[model samples]
Target: MTFFAPRDAETSLHCPDCGTRLHIARSCREVHMYCPACRAHYPLREYIHRADEAMERFLENVYCDRIE
Candidate 1:
């Protein structure tokens, strides 16, 4: 579960590992993300914490929060 705000709904975000779009689950207490493209899991915010740590920020924002 996550503690994302309602504003997170309209925001664009994605997973750091697979580079797939992600959704904000308010029911969650922390920011958790996953990439359908690669089926990888990672912590939110930290997704883009570094350059070599994950994919490009632009690519991560591609399908961010567009799906549930």
Candidate 2:
């Protein structure tokens, strides 16, 4: 079945300016991110990139035993 609204996925995005956790909803079409704390809208790509970077850092720490 086809859907109109965006698909819900678990995501943890932090505002680059305020460090506030941001919510994400993915869609078949393009979508942008709006941060209420900072009153700014960021491209979806930017949010994804940030998320990727964060995950990479976390994995590195875990593998290197930096996190306990």
Candidate 3:
């Protein structure tokens, strides 16, 4: 069974390897993402972490710009 946050449901997912659309597979503690185009399989946790970091950096930049 696959469970995703409501926010994730709204965004499109793509494979990092082949630029193909990714579909979520079984989900428990970690979610599996598969790329049919490239036969790539990986966990979504890493991608979520990366996205969180990027968002934090972007927010920091925006805050700095506002203060300046």
- Superposed model 3: Cα runs more than 4 Å off: 1-11, 27-30, 49-68
Error of 1 at 30 (Å): 5.8
Where model 1 places Cα greater than 4 Å from the true spot, the runs are 1-11, 16-18, 24-31, 45-68
> By summed lDDT, which 10 consecutive residues of candidate 2 come out lowest?
59-68
Q: Sorted on TM-score, highest at the top, how do the candidates line up?
A: 3, 2, 1
Candidate 2 accuracy as TM-score: 0.44
For residues 1-68, what per-residue lDDT tens digits would candidate 2 score against the true structure? 97343333324677788877655443445345556667666666665445554344333322222222
Better of 1 and 2 by lDDT: 2
lDDT of 3 by residue, 1-68 (tens): 97433212211467788888665444434345577778788755545444443334333323122221
State the TM-score for model 1. 0.30
Better of 2 and 3 by lDDT: 2
Pairs in clash, predicted candidate 1: 1-28, 2-28, 3-28, 13-64
- Candidate 1, backbone clash total: 4
**Clash totals, every prediction:** 4, 0, 0
Q: Give one digit per residue, the lDDT tens place, for model 1 in 1-68.
A: 86422423312455655546754323334445555456665554554443332244333434445223
Off by over 4 Å in 2: 1-10, 25-29, 50-68
